[model samples]
Target: MGWLRGDCVGRGSFATVNLAVCSQFTTPTVVKSSDVFSSSSLKNEKQVLDRLGLCPEIIRCFGDDYTTENGEDFYNLFLEYASGGTLFDQLKNHGGRLPESDVRRYIRSIIRGLAYIHDKGFVHCDIKLQNILVLGNGDVKIADFGLAKRTEEKQSMCECRGTPLSMSPESVNDNEYEPPADVWALGCAVVEMVTGKPAWNVKEGSNIFSLMLRIGLGDELPEVPNELSEAGKDFLSKCFVKDPRKRWTAEMLLKHPFVADNTLSSKTSSPRCHFDFPDWVSAGTASVPCSPESVEWSEWKFDSVRWSNCTSPVDRLRQLVTDKKPNWSESDSWCLVSRHQRTV
Candidate 1:
């Protein structure tokens, strides 16, 4: 089906995410596009999503296509649009922290998604609040599978695949990204949700190397919020285990009392909130600015003879001045000091 691209909602280092409406659907969808040459990650995401297929807890991918605009080719992947934005957005709306009840609901959904991915022999290398999308009905789904890989795939040494704040001990030390590492990241997300702060106590301007050392070798774990219920704390305990082997798996966490209890309503009764694209400077479409015919390009041009590959200090100083004389203004002239002025 043909789709019309709408406002550009987001831009990453390698891709642009825009709202789109397909001819066959009434609801708007999201189209993530990247230049054909830099689309490997997007293509990988499409393949992984297709392999995992049809899990309600996971984000749905409609399909992908190649399109050309302004003589440039782009690869586009269509995704289910989450009008409610991300879990991080919800946290900002709710005063930086979510109620325990809400946290439980969200965590339950995430665990279910993780369980499914792990069961499929895949590991979601990155799992954080920003990666979780909330639907209009308050249901959350796991999104952004760019870093996902098969569970059996061995990670290269010294390569970190996720945000450092959420990195598990095993991931930090051994570059191992297994299912348990995701659970550790899940624990970080849980703490952030409950306290409205990062799980790790990383101070401003703190050395990242030292932090990694602490995470991998210092035997320190994120402090569980005292405000949390005993069951909630216990649940976090299972996730924060330093040893990956002992860490509770997603399947195991699903049965924990904190999440297993379904008496509490999981759905939000409030109306679905739409994200305001404040960061989007353009409307309808992204366009490149055309040079105005009124401006003279020749006047702005510099003499090619003025530049060179010289690296000496004298050469650098010579390059700073131009052949043309400076147009000095009134302010450029130094004021003469009065004779009455005394030296300080």
Candidate 2:
């Protein structure tokens, strides 16, 4: 496959993604390549994508090959080009957080992909906004399967892979995991989509040990984004359950109010909200190390109702700040305010 490689688009620990075009094809595509000696492991990812071929919500893989550039032998994988880039880029474009409706649509697509992958006996060990690719039509597809493995593959105890902030509690603690671990990561991605921040309050250069303790050993979980709807919060509660045995499966979560269509009845039960803090996290010897940017969230209200109007001064203030337009006299502004207030 003598495809002409063009500009480099992405760089990761294992591979570099570049724009590529073939003589027979009219559209630009992306090719991910890594040194043959590097551990990026394109072979495994190619196998996973090949087995999971033709999913509308998953990035398509054309084929793979070997190429040498500048005396280095490299293995390469060709993938569908997501013109809209990644979900992480999308979130940044929206000023850190995406609108709830967009988040709902993206999450629904992701669930479909996850369901298919799990049904096929594989787990997408890494599920984060950065691995989610947005298409030109605004649809999203799950990408980057380098860390994925078969459900039957035994994991080492306390084995951690993928991004730290998006990892599941079980992955952080016992290191034993199954499909539910992806659901946990999905929950973290949703929180990031809504809050423009990682699920933990910890920040850059903070104590990673403390972060892991909070995620794995605590009765406390990641803070639900304040901007999310009650249904959204409840949905996260299901994903963040301490017990994977009791966690909602992707099939079950599809019917959750947060992701289901408006006409679809949400038969989802209330998310579990109680647990004892792990002994290590609760040891009063020292407060968990935190960053200056760390945020403290209050208890989430599972039974809260959405507000339909700016019925109070506080609501008005919230509207003004969130909408970013303080024009009180314009009816259009009032409409904007009401629209966002409904998300409360």
Top TM-score prediction, candidate number: 2
Off by over 4 Å in 1: 263-344
lDDT of 1 by residue, 103-212 (tens): 99999999999999999989988788878999999999999887788997974442345655688888766678899999999998998888776676644333344456
Sequence-dependent TM-score of model 1: 0.75
**Clash count per candidate:** 0, 0
TM-score for each predicted model, relative to the true structure: 0.75, 0.76
User: 179-202, model 2: which lDDT tens digit per residue?
Assistant: 999998899889888877667665
lDDT agreement with native, every candidate? 0.70, 0.68
Cα error, residue 217 of model 1, in Å, equals 1.2
- Candidate 2, superposed: residue stretches over 4 Å from native: 24-27, 263-344
Q: Give the TM-score of candidate 2.
A: 0.76
For model 1, which pairs clash? none
